[model samples]
Target: METLVFRFEQGQRRIPTAAQLVGVVSSGNLEVLVSRAELQAACEIEVNTAAIGFAPIWQAVMDDFQARWQLADVRIAINDMGATPAVVSLRLDQAIEACLESAP
Candidate 1:
C-alpha cells in the first residue's frame, strides 16, 4: 500500500460554507479527517495503496481544488488505497463538507 499526506491550515476567515468527506475503496480504500485549528488555512492528505506512478496527478488534483475553491484557510487529510482520480476528488469534496458542517 502507498500513502500520501496533504495538510492545510486556514485562519479565522470564515472557511468554506460546506465540507464533505468521501471514501473510495477498490481493493484499496481512502480515509480523510479534517478539523479546525488556530492557524492559517491548510490541508493534510494521506494516501495509502498499491497503485503507483501518479504522484504528480494527485498533486495536480489537490492544486486544482485549491484554485477552484480559492481556499487559503483549511486542513485536509486523505488516506487512499488504489482509489481512482474521480474517487479522490469526491473524497476531498466530502471532507470539505464534513469540515464545514462541524465548524464551530
Candidate 2:
C-alpha cells in the first residue's frame, strides 16, 4: 500500500515516532491516538475537548481527515487542550503518518 509520509517536526527536535505508532500519543496541548480497527468497521473519530464553541472547527478537521486518508478501519481519538484548528490538523496528520509508517 502507498502511504503518505510527511516531516512532522523540523531541526533537532524531530524524533522518529513510527515505531511508537501503536497506542502512541503526540503533541502537548493536543493528544492524538491513531490505531487499527476491525476490517469491517468504519473510521471512528472521537474528540474530547474543553472548547465547546469549536464544534464546527472540529468537524472540519474530521472531514479533512476522512478526505486525506483511506481510514476505512482506523480509530482516531483526540484530546484537545484549547488548541487552534491548525494545531489540531497538524497533530492529526502527524499521528496518522506515524501509524502508517509503523504498520508491518
Candidate 3:
C-alpha cells in the first residue's frame, strides 16, 4: 500500500456553479468530500493505490476541469483508490454535486 499527498488553495472565484457527482468502482473507485467554505467550495482527495508514474495524467484531468468549469474560490482534496483517470473525473463531478447540496 502506498500513499500520495498534495494540497491546493482555491480562490472564491474558482468554485463551480451547479455541479454534478458521478463515478465508478471497477478498477477505479473514488471517494470524495466537498463543502462550501469561506471562499466557496473546497475539495480534498486521497488515493489508496495507483498505476505509478501517472501524475501528469492526473494533473491533466484536474486542469481540464478547472478550465472547462472556470471554478473559483474552490478548494479540492482528492483520494483515489487505484481509480482510472475517467473515474477521477466522475468522482470529482460527484463531489461537486455534494458541494451544491451543502452550499449555503
Q: Pick the candidate with the highest TM-score.
A: 2
**Please, what are the lDDT tens digits per residue for candidate 3 over residues 1-104?**
44554334453343444433344344356655444345434333344454676767776776665555444545455556677778777777766656666555
Model 1 C-alpha lDDT per residue in residues 1-104, reported as the tens digit of each score: 55666554552334544444555453237765554443455544555646777888887887776655545545556666667777767766776666667767
- What ranking of all candidate models by lDDT puts the best one first? 1, 2, 3
Candidate 3 colliding pairs, count: 31
lDDT of 1 at 85: 77
Q: What is the C-alpha local distance difference test score of each model?
A: 0.60, 0.58, 0.55
Cα lDDT for residue 57, model 2? 70
When 1 and 3 are scored with lDDT, the better candidate is 1
Candidate 3 regions exceeding 4 Å error are 1-28, 36-49, 102-104
Worst 10 residues of 1 by lDDT: 11-20
* TM-score list, all predictions: 0.64, 0.69, 0.58
TM-score of 3: 0.58
